[model samples]
Every structure is written in structure tokens, then in C-alpha cells.
Target: MLTQIQASFAVNALTVSMAGITTDLDTPATSVGTAITAGTFAMAAFILLGAKVGSRFGTRGVFQIAVAIHGLAMLGVALSVSPAMLFIAQASSGAVIALIAPALTVFIATNYHGAQQARAIGFLAAAIPAAGVLALILAGWFATTIGWRWSFVLMVALAGVNLVLSFLVKKVPAQPGLSIDWTGAIIAAVAVILLSFGFSGLATWGIWLATPQAPFDVLGISPAPLLVILGLVVGQVFFSWLRRRGREGKPRIFDLRVLATGSERAVTACMATMLFVGTAANFLIPLYIQVVQGRSSIETSFSIIPYTLSIFLASTFVAYLYGRFTPRLLATTGFIVVAAALTLLAFTVRGEWSQGFVVAGLILLGLGQGSIVALVFNTLLSAAPKQLAGDVGAWRGLVHNLSGSVGIAVASAFAVGMLSSMLLAGAQEHPEISDELIAQVNFNEANFLTNEQLAAVLESRASGPELDAAIAVNAEARLRALQISLLGLGAISLLAIVPATRMPGRREGDLPEKLEPDDDDVIDPVDEKETVA
Candidate 1:
């Protein structure tokens, strides 16, 4: 479980680091485009397929296959020469992750008893940020010094380690009479691809509210809104068809009935909400550090170290808290803390001491998000039936990945819109400035702008013009853009509070008391089987 957890964490960190790499290697717009759309598609496809494969081949087989695929994908990414190739590589990696994630969670649930299961899941959850810290630190340093390509090479090494560890995994017996639902898989894939593409288009073209002047148009007839509508229609039809198939006793990709349980529903909601907030923060913070604070990639990564440590520490503490306190309290408290952190951050955006406040906010947010993630995973495994563990785990992972994709998409759109507005307004106010100079203000490369660019802009200004005034206006616009982005993030965080409230309150410490076991139950049948196998 620990090895699998570590491997998953490494893969996850590599996946997230793609966003930063996109910024370093290409334009922000293109980076967001490739990362969000391709990543979403890859993840959704992987989840759907992983569930089927796990049921047919067993968790161990799925794990081994995924590890091999992941290694190959990393190697491909390291050698990628174009954006298309990179996206393909990332998609492959995403699929491998989808296969391994749920299997790992189910493995723990199947192998361990109640409280031990929670602790194990908590450890797995903690590994996410722990691995992220390592990846972020290394990615920043390596990208700054050796180039972004080397960072992908580093992932190849991690993937190699994961592949080697796969050999140590014990084989799991597959469930009898299970079969793949190819029809459902096709439908699900189509729906996911359509929806992700639609959202990607919206993110690029700008949502209606964000760009009201740009009317809806599909190939000149408002393509953005139309595509979004089409995606929704397709998704609804797909689900309706699945429902009919289920009623007719035919195989379905997703068993909607499994989601009827309170625990399942609550855990799914918590996972989605936590991931939404966590990923949004991850997407936005680095931009703020680089653009607004004028920090290098290495400096920004270092600045985030405290937040990463807090997440790891908080996740570790969650294992101990699980049996002692209800998930409800922990999850709710986490939401509140995250929301508070965002609100506090809103107040310090323009101050000279903003970095300190930002750090504080990140720490608190990490603490809350980390705890909620651990709780959700533990609750998910506990709630799922043993026989359907793989399916349940796959479903949970799907929710997490989908949430992350949506979060990144929404956050990127919001940040870009906000920044664009700021730039436009600033330009209008400073009509004396040349449009050429305004165009040269690369928001994405704000941290690494050449002195020549600044000098050219300054020299173009009116004679005797106050240089401080120009600098102040530009700085103010950038700060305001970041502030607006953070506000949007806070609003998103607020949406999570209600969902988190529904999470089960069971704690690890209370599990033994709540689940009284007879003497015969003290020994696990799975453990005996494992010993024999």
C-alpha cells in the first residue's frame, strides 16, 4: 500500500507540474489549453477503462499494467518535441494514473481492518503533497537551471522506480462472471471528450458573462455557447441510455445505484469539493508569485514550501484524528479554514507584506484541504462493498480528476479574464502610453522580462513624465488582476462548504467502539488468503 501510494503521489505531482512547465516552455494561453483539455480527456478515459480492467484482471494486474504504461508515458514526455506529442504523453500518463489510483485505495480497504484502513488511506493522502513538495522543489530548480525538459526526464526516473515496485505487488483474484461493457465505455468516452472539449473552448473563447461583447457564435454563429449546449445534451442522452440499459439488466459502464448510498454520495461530494479548491489554489498561486510578487520560479517554489509542508503535516495528523473525531467536524473545519484563508488573503493583496499573508493563507488552505482529502478517501473505502471495491475506487478517482480539471479550467479562465480587464482598463487610463509598449508587457513572463523591454517602454514615454507614475500604474494593474483572481477562488471555495458538511463524521479512534468485533472476527480472511497465495 505504501509503495503504491508513493508511486501514485509521484505521478500526481508530475501531472500537476505540467502546468508550470507549460508556462516555462510556452505561452500561458497555450499551456492552459493543452493542460486542461488533454488532461481532462485522459483522466476521464482512464477512470472508465480502469474500472473495467480491474474487475476483469484484478487490482494487482491493473497496478502492474498501469506502472508499465506510466513509465513509457514519462519517457515519451521527456523526449516530446511538440505540444501535440506532450499532450499525448500526458494523456497516457493520465490513463495509467486512473488505473492505479482506485486499485491502490481498494487494496488498502481489502487488506486492512477498519481503523487501520483509515490510517492507511490517510497516509496515502499525505503522500500527495509530500510528493508534490519534492516535485515542485525539483521542477523549479531544474527548470530554472537545466531547462523544463530535464524535469520530464526526472519523472522518467520516478516512473522507473514505480515499475520496479510493481513486481512486489501481490496478485488479486478477479471477481467471477464480470465482463466489460464496451458500449457503455464508448458512450462514456464520447460524452467525456465532448464535455471537456466544450469547456476548453469556453475557457479559450471566454464565457458569455466574461466576454459579453463577444456574442454567441458557432463558426460565426456563437460556437462557444452552442458547443456547451451540445455537450450537455450528449451527456444527458448518454446517461439516460445507460439508465435504460441498467433497467434492462444489461451491462453499464457506471452503476448509478451504487451512488445512492449516503456515505458514497457524501464522500464523492467531499472529494470533488476538496479537489476543486485545492487545484484552483495550485493553479493560481504560482502565477501570483511570479507576476505580482516578481519572484523567480525557484523563489516561488520555495515560497510554497510552507504550504506543502502544512498539507503533509495535516494529512499525517488526519490518520490519528479519523477514529477519534467524526469526518463531518474535520471536513467542515477544513472548509472553514480554507475559506478564511482566502478571505484573509483578499485583504493583503496590495500590501508590501502580502507575501507573508499569502504564505499564511496557503498554509491554512493546505491544512484544511489535506484533512478533507484523507477523510474522503477513508470514508469512501469504508462505505463501499468489498466486492465492488475496485469499481467504487474508480468512481471516486473519476470525481477527483474531473474536479481537478474543472478547477484548473475555471481558475485559468477567471485569471485570464481578470488580467485582460485590468490591462485594458490600465491602457485606457494611460492613453499617453504606446500600444506597442502595452503589448510588450508579457504577463506570463513578468518575472523574466528583459531590462531592455522596460527601458524601451520608458524611453517612449512623454518627456519629463514621472517614471514612478508609470511603474505604479503597471504594478497596480497587475496586483488588481491577482486580487480579482483570488476573489474568484474564494467564491469557489465557499461552494465547497455545504458539500463538506454532508461528509460522515466517523473517526478512526471511534471505529473500534462503533464496529464491535467478535473473537472470530479478529482474524481477517484476506490476510490468511494472502499468506497462502
Candidate 2:
């Protein structure tokens, strides 16, 4: 619970702090998004490696060390004065989290029985949004009062608490002789980095032809799509390599048995899709409130309270419905609600920080996303064998981070792309804004800014009338971009309903399957060791 809340604290603090950080670091919003992406991508890259390392050492030992290191990393975040430093700090925290994630499941599976385990899993899932509520209020206050830096400072204190509490967790035995799968780790890292960077570059690197912002191009074409294709191919290669290692009786990075069934795979896909949508919406909402509307952090928090509270309530209480509904029915209904909520948001949001209809949409969104988030884990954990609980946790962590990273990156790129095109077209059509002013601004960079930020960028290049015209164009463009993006996301969510139908099924009124922990899976709370193959 502590580790999961720590992870959520990092995300929530940084999330509400994006606008302030962008201003402080003198960088674009995408840079802030990249700092977030760096952390999430690191979570994906180091998860398997962390699992192997936990096995080599011991779960309890790794958990303690990771907690301590994360505290240090949170300190780094507090002191960071530049985008690069922020990225490094966040990435370090994320990598350390990978080591702690597997232990969460191990402790639960090793210590708890059937109903206790289900309740434990619900608490685990609920921790995220619960932390979000706390972080938002606290971070919002910090950002509006002292500074955004103090938000991370609080995390440093929390980390100490977690480190002390971690010792209470029961220890699990280790497989000291299980060699690390370095080959698979390398492949996985490459795939994730390629995908994350490629998605981020789509806004800067031209969608079709090469843009000056691109590092390099493939022939005359943009490298973004090429990199995305390469990432997909490399991902497939990683899976193929896993198959080969299994055939050869070599130590594989992941045990394929965790996802061997079609139901498991479908659950994973649904999880990814829901996370992708949820994270994207999370990113866009703050971006609009803080950057576009020029609201303070406290106001941002107030506006978002409805959403966060709804998620917390839904996640905590969704388990009770498990007895009355099948996982498939629950999941399909959840996705449908998600789609409706997003569509409502797309149509209702316009030129304001808060409105009755907008709050309604946010409430609906939280209920849908929170329930789905809790349900997928509940279903996966209940159905999978007890011995594989740690692996299931690692798998859930991987998908959560990867999908979330891509969601933010893609949303940033998409919104930026829309800003560029609409800004240009709006400029050309406006009577006051001249061609000279348009030529002066570097639209290729795709840095969407508020009226004040735009004026600073233009400096003396634009007269009052010209600047007003530009700002008018910019304001409308940003709004439309956000609206269109939300609609597209809604469409994607509706598509997920098809796959949700394929998730683990249960008879009406049937509780989720829960098995007793294997005798070998647990060890002495005092001291016990295992070196099994």
C-alpha cells in the first residue's frame, strides 16, 4: 500500500505541477510531458529486470532498498531546476518502483487467504486514486503557496514512512541461482524507448515529410512513423525470443504461463486500452486548465476534485458488485460508460475552468475508469494461480506504465499537431495578423502557449491588433484540438467494448475465483530461504 501510494504521489504531484514546472524551467508543456514519459517508460523497461533481481536477492530486501532509493530520487525532484534534471529524477524513481512492484503481490499472496486476498487486491487498486485525492489537495496548495517544488519535498518525507513500514511485510524465499535474462531486457528496453520517443516526436517531426525539429529522417520521410514500425517489429522479436528461450529451457525474462490463455491476453489488452484513454484524459485536462485557461494550481485542483473523488469511491466499492455481475458484463458496461463520458466531455467543454455539464462528464469518467482499473486486477489476480501472483503484479505494472506513457506522449503530439495546423490556417485567414508576423514565429516547434506566453514569444514582432488576432486564433485552435482529441479517444474506448466481452466470464452472482496460497509460496516471518529451480 505504501509503495503504490508513493508511485501515485509522484504522478499526482508532477501532474498538477506541469504548468508551474514549464514556466520555471522555461520549456514547453511537451517537455513536462516528456519528463512524465521518461518515468513511465523506465517502469516498463526495468520491471522484468527488477523481478529477476528480486529473485536473486530477496523480495523484502529489494523492497526496503527500493523504498530508500525512491526517497533519494524524490529529493532529486525537489531540487531539480531544469527539464533534464527532472527527467533523470523521475526516471530513477520509476526504475526503483519496478523493484518494489513485484513484492506487493508477493506479500499479499504469501500472507493472505481467499476473501482477505480479494479485499487486499481492492485496497491495492484503490490506493492510486486515494493518493490522487491527497496529492492533488496538498500539491495544489503547495503550488499556489510556496512552490511546486515543495510537493515533491512531501514525497521525500512519505518515502521514509514507507521504508519503515516495509519491514513489517513478510519475507519470501529467493531463487538465488536464477540467472538474469539480459538479452530479453535489452530487447524490451529498445522497444519501449523507440515507441515512446517516436510517439513524442510525431508533433515535432512532420507527420509526413521531415521537419527541421526531427533529429534525422529516413530517406525524405519523417522518422517518426518509421521508428514506430521498428518498435512494433522489435516488440514481436522480443516475444519470439521469449518463445525460443522457453523451448531451449533457458531462463526467460517473463513466464509465458501468466498470459497463456486467450482470456488473460484479452484482459491485458482491455487494461492497456482503458489506461491509454484514462491517462490521455488526465494529461489533457490539467494542460487545458493550467496552460490554456491560465488557472492557478489550487483552482485546477478544485476543478478536478469531482473526478478524483468519484474514482476513489468507485475503486473502493466496485468489488461488492462482483458478486452480482460477471466480469465480462462489468467490463463491457464500464467501457461503454467511459465512451459516453468522453463524448460528453468533448461536446460540453468550452472556454471555461468549470461548468455544470463539464463536472458531470468528469464524474462519469471517474466512475468508469476507476471501476475498470479495479476490476481488471481483481479478475486477473483471482483467476491466475497463487504461485504466479508476483508475476501478475509485474505484468500489471508493465501495462500500466507503458500504456500510460504512450497515452501522454500521443495526446501531446496530437494536440500540438492540431495547434500548428489550426494556428497557421487561422493566421492566414485573419485580416490583422500579417504574413511577416507568421514568418517570425516558429510554428514548426508546435509549442502551444497562452495569450501571455504568446506575447512574450512574439515580443515586438507583433503589434497589439496582430497579437490579439494571434491569441484569438490560438485560443480557438487549442479548444478545438482538445475537443477533437477527446472524441477520438471516446471512439477508441467504444472499440474496447468488443474485447471486454472476451474477458473472464462468471455466472451471475458468482464471486471471483480465489485459490488458497500454495504451501511453498510462503516462508517464515522470521527467516527462511529457498533455492528452487
> Each model's TM-score?
0.79, 0.84
Query: Which stretch of 10 consecutive residues in model 2 shows the poorest summed lDDT?
Result: 523-532
Off by over 4 Å in 2: 14-37, 76-89, 143-150, 420-447, 451-473, 507-533
Error of 1 at 462 (Å): 6.6
lDDT of 1 by residue, 236-352 (tens): 887787667655666667655445445557668878877887888887777677666666656676778888889888877887776557777777777778888877776676434
Question: Distance (Å) between predicted and true CA of 341, model 1?
Answer: 0.7
lDDT of 2 by residue, 292-411 (tens): 788876777778888988987888788888878889999999999999999999999876755888889999999999999988887877666555666788889888877876787788
lDDT of each: 0.65, 0.81
* lDDT (Cα, 0-100) at 215 in candidate 1: 39
Return model 2's CA RMSD, one decimal.
5.9
lDDT of 2 at 342: 94
